[model samples]
Target chain A: MMGAPLLEVRNLESFYGPIMAIRGVSLSVEEGQIVTVLGANGAGKSTLLKTISGIMDPEKGSVSFDGAEIQGEEPHRIVSRGIVHVPEGREVFPLLSVDENLSLGAYTRKDRSAIERDREMVFEYFPILAERRHQEAGTLSGGQQQMLAIGRGLMLRPRIMLLDEPSLGLSPLLVQEIFAILGRLNREEGVTMMLVEQNARIALELAHVGYVMEIGRIVMNGDADRLMQSEDIKAFYLGQQEAGQRSEKRWKRKKTWR
Target chain B: MDGVQLLVSGLANGCVYGLIALGFVLIYKATEAVNFAQGDFMMLGAFVTLGLTNAEYLHLPFWIAAPLAILIMAFFGYLLDLLILRHLFGQSQTAVVILTIALGFVIRFVAGVIWGHEPQTLESPLAFGDVSLGGVVLGMADVAVIVVTVLLTWSLYQFFQRTKLGLAMQAASQNQMAAYFMGIPVKRVQGLIWGLSGATAAVAGILFASKGAIDPNAGLLGIKAFAAAVIGGFGSLPGALAGGLIVGVIEPFAARYLAAGYSQIAPYALLLAVLVFRPHGLFSQVRTKKV
Candidate 1:
């Protein structure tokens, strides 16, 4: 919260054809903080990210970043301005090699030496991508492709990273490891991030601030640890499963494969 | 003139089809929509060259004049992308396909109004003398057709692989939305791909005109280029050239043995046969979309 908030969404509303996905939504991200938007399926989390990134346009509200208004800017222009979105479903170019995918992420940059340096940093984060740099991404396992997807997003050296359900298809072990990396990246580099995820427990544990959405509106917002203690959250989200028992259920899910 | 002489000429004609087909392959790889007006692109190129040569405004040789006309053709391609084709982005496959078809008709009609339907001969670098190789005769013009095509294809290959812009084009063609997220100028990439396709078409037109017949509806033979694309797999560049060669080489043999009837359908027949077995194409990446 030093200079200014990194991103601010004020009264944002977006539509899909005739259906209103979100109505009168507002949020804010501090310059160097991890903000998590937690909600169940169809709660408009992905739509919010898409609208801010310019993949979709909102009929109302404003998306301002670092004091510059960027509501209607094209997605390509938005990326060059350093807001990188790692979309859901790991849409890596299936025919391209891992190295090529990473290089393409830096398409608008002119500093060749820095791009090379960043490439090494990305490989350090995801060693599997480095190991399979020459292999086509489509051939990689789902978890590996997900890593590559994140790695591709990192190539732009983005100031604010928007991730949608990063742990969706990952194993429990991998999920824990990925969240740890997100936490470390935020702490060490101060790269602001917005994570929209279904894993409420982990999202709440890692995020400094949390916002809960139901039926396309923020029903609750507070400190992550404090939100976890809210009776409504505990009753609606945590009531379905015991708190510590998620680990056991996750184990059972993993054991089926084993 | 003997059987060998006829074969050489036939192969040379086949090279022309391959050249135009490369344009088809180029645009298709970057945008899955077929520019039905592709043959028209070639026709436009040749027509431009003809107009330039007729005007003698630059007072340059064919070498200089040919490249200049191609540059103009590239501009037309860019304009086409900006004006009509760009709107088709992210649209349904069938809608884009039909849009291109309509655009092709517009280009054809414009060319007919400008350049009348009389055939004219271009200045051939080849002298009238023909060399007989083992009883096979090849005029220098015929050799020029094959040589020009090979050289053009080699240059295009280098353009696609070694250059940064070319690699970006490849990435954009594969998944444009992801490309946009990757910081690529997706709109510029689309415009440039159309420019490349137009330039390639122009070169093919000039080479064919050098051999014989420069007319307005000269785009008629552009149908063969479509066959080349289909035979080669619409998405594969090398496959298109190979498909062009296959169609080119087969027709003469078809004419010689199959009573001249099957010769015309050689490329289309080859396309149908390939589609029946390898629907993705001979060299295209095979993929399955989730239902």
Candidate 2:
């Protein structure tokens, strides 16, 4: 929080047709820190990540990564600048082989030996991908597809990775496994991450700092541990309250934040 | 003997169709837009080569004229993306289709203005005596056609499977959004794809004109290539080649054994039957949209 953040967004506004999807949203992620944006469905969480990654252009404000502004630049150019967006729904190229998908992740780089080494590294991280390297990506299960998507992102050797809904369709066990990998990636490799998720509990558990967005605006922001302990957060996000004692009438008496 | 002769001729014709069909499939795969102007591009190719080789025009030798025409066509295709198609990105697919159809007409009219109304024969190095085997005869031009088709197809196979740039093209074609996220310059790659397709169409045009006379109306041959693409599966490369060969072979066979009228309708009939049985084409990946 003291030094200049690795990624900084200020007064960002994005629209889809006439409707504003994310408005006046501002946040920052320091290098090597894991930051999570938690929100419910239709809260513009995906929009925030998409705007920052240059998948969608912002109408107002700025996004600066490593001290360089990158608003309205092309997605490919943004990636070359060291930011990679793993889009929502894990959009792996269905017709391509797993190996081909991995190779494509390093598309922007020219270092031949490094690319080969990274390909091997990705396979090592996801051994099942190695086994199915020759198989079409579409044939993989939902969990496996998610792994492939993250694996593809890793091949970029990106400085800042923007991940959207990594746990969206994953089973509980698979989600734990993926979150563990994300934690390891942050801890060991020092890769900065901006994770947008609806799974608040696990997301807060993984992140050092957290932001809560509601209807295209950041409603609350604090340290992850402090947010987890907040009474309003407990009543709304976690559904756990001090006095409730797990009663069936908990929904009836819960304070509405909206 | 008559059957063998007809088969050989049919295959030669099919190879020409396959070349044109490759252009159609390449554009369709990369952009998901069926370029109606693809056949018109072929017509332009023939006209350019004619302008270069005809005694009254540039009067260059066939060797120089053919390569020069191919290069011109490639540049023309690249310009098309930069000047026209790039502006239409993110628009409705139907709008793009209609624009391409209109483009086909524009190319045809321009070709007519430049070349004229009369059909012109193209001269190639192989346009000479026929090679007879027992009772069957094979034109040297036809042999050249087969050799060029095999070589072109083989090289394209190597490109898509072996080369990095080719792999980038495949990735762009499969999922443009994901490709962009993966740091591929999708727009530039798309322009390159259009150029590649144009160059391919040029080769097809030259091979086709070598066998007969070509006129501005010859651009209508694109409809046959379109039919070939549909039969092969619109996005599959090998399917395009197979589809073209099937259509090409069927026409001559129907004309001889059946009736000339049957030959005219054979390609459409085959298309209808395939649509009823396998709408996705023979080699297409059947995709299910995820919720």
Candidate 3:
């Protein structure tokens, strides 16, 4: 990467009331690149994204965005600086209409014309959102809600988006459709993204770089293709197994990366 | 003719109660803290208008004094949240309830010191007039009160339904965390809500003062308004007004038709009945908070 990366987190540590969630986590995402963090449940993937987005204050570490430190700033302040966090569980305002949710995405922007254009662009990206623009967001299906969450993020015209989990609770085909759109968004709009996901296969396919987290620590970091090819990743995360090996024994075996 | 006369007067009083209930609902919706001082805020609003329009004071005209009082009260509400209530964040909701109760006491004492214990009549252009429709007669003051309440309610509805800031306020009230993520400045929005609530209370106070005599103790009427809020379903705005009307209409009829002094307990009796039969109130908008 040339020049400074778009977002850099160094030695980041956050806590959930004395229980450290992410410790000494160091990572960087270059401009316009999709960086995916893959982990099992309780791997602190969500915590890392929350910390970067200023939803959770870090006890120790620095989060620099475009050469400016933003740690400990309020979430809204961080958002105004162009980092939008699409929180886990698609936390769209349940009572609000889809159009209202989208309007709120651009809440910090003052350029009315640009906002109107962005609104049209979001509708183009997720046509279902346009159709249900007047319907309450709570009525949406899980897949549609996830799409609304992403489309809402796009309304910010954000420099970087920290997506906790886009593919969560979606069907296999729906995940493919969402990931394809994400890939297009990155390529066409140049929106830098740091995505955290439990679904490793599809996340790896679209990501330029991948980091594997376990027990609140990063154990592996490499190019996406290389991580996909790693025998350890294949056996543990990808559900591949050696011939004649029982699943119980595979679970009992210690992870090679650790 | 007698019945129509009673209805008009009852409706005017009900509008006052509804406006006060609105103040309660606005603050409750935003912060989930019931301002026990809401009635006292109304008392203070009336006192402020008196100080502005009284012959011995600034002596401003009623039209000028009322809006100025509302504006001043609105700013006071904003500052109250910014300086005091803002610190109460993360504390238990019970703490806020207790603090606001104490605030009510302090407000009453301060009002007593400023305006004295004597009841005062607010001067108004409509104070001396009456309009007769066939055999039924309506006081101009009562008519004005009903008109102003309707206009205010309609404008408030338009604001919450149409404006971006209004939608943002609704968003913040619904989910503070999600609102902040959207860069809506949730704290500031909360302060604005407080201001709006204060302005609403001032309008209620002015209406109450116009139709009747006001003193520091006049704020005690807020108890009836609180009952009205409960009867309407505490969460819904229109419900608050309807609840107020229910309480207001019940009083005169109970007094005239029932035994002597029964009017004093009618609103509370209705409140108890609603609590037993429909605990969530008439137009309950209560939804379980999304986890």
Which candidate has the top score in DockQ?
2
What's the lDDT for all of these models?
Answer: 0.82, 0.89, 0.90
DockQ of each: 0.47, 0.70, 0.55
Top TM-score hit: 2
Candidate 2 residue B142 C-alpha distance from true site, Å? 1.2
Interface RMSD of 2: 1.4
Candidate 2 scores a chain A TM-score of: 0.94
What tens digits encode model 1's per-residue C-alpha lDDT throughout B171-254? 888887788778788888889989988898888888888777777677877788788778787888888887777887788878
Q: How far off is residue B254 in model 1, in Å?
A: 1.1
Query: Rank by lDDT, descending?
Result: 3, 2, 1
What interface RMSD does every candidate have?
A: 2.3, 1.4, 2.4
Point out where model 1 deviates above 4 Å. A238-258, B1-11, B54-59, B88-91, B126-135, B289-291
Question: Tens digits of per-residue lDDT for model 1 on A1-258?
Answer: 677688999999999778899887899999788999998999999999999899899999999998999998989889989999998878788788999888887887889999999899888878889999999888888788888888889889898999999888788998898888888778876778999988898888889999988667887788998989875566556554445644445324321111
Write one digit per residue (lDDT tens) for candidate 3, span B1-291. 888888889999999999999999999989999998999999999899989998988999888999999999999999999999999998999999999999999999999998899999888665678998886789988998999999999999999988889999988987777788888888899999999999999998888888988999888889999999999999889999999998888887888888887778989999999999999999887654333
TM-score of 2: 0.96
Lowest summed lDDT across 10 adjacent residues in model 3 chain A is found at A242-251
A best-first ranking of the candidates according to their TM-score comes to: 2, 3, 1
| Candidate that beats the other on TM-score, 2 or 3, i.e. the better one | 2
Q: For candidate 3, list the clashing residue pairs, or say none.
A: none
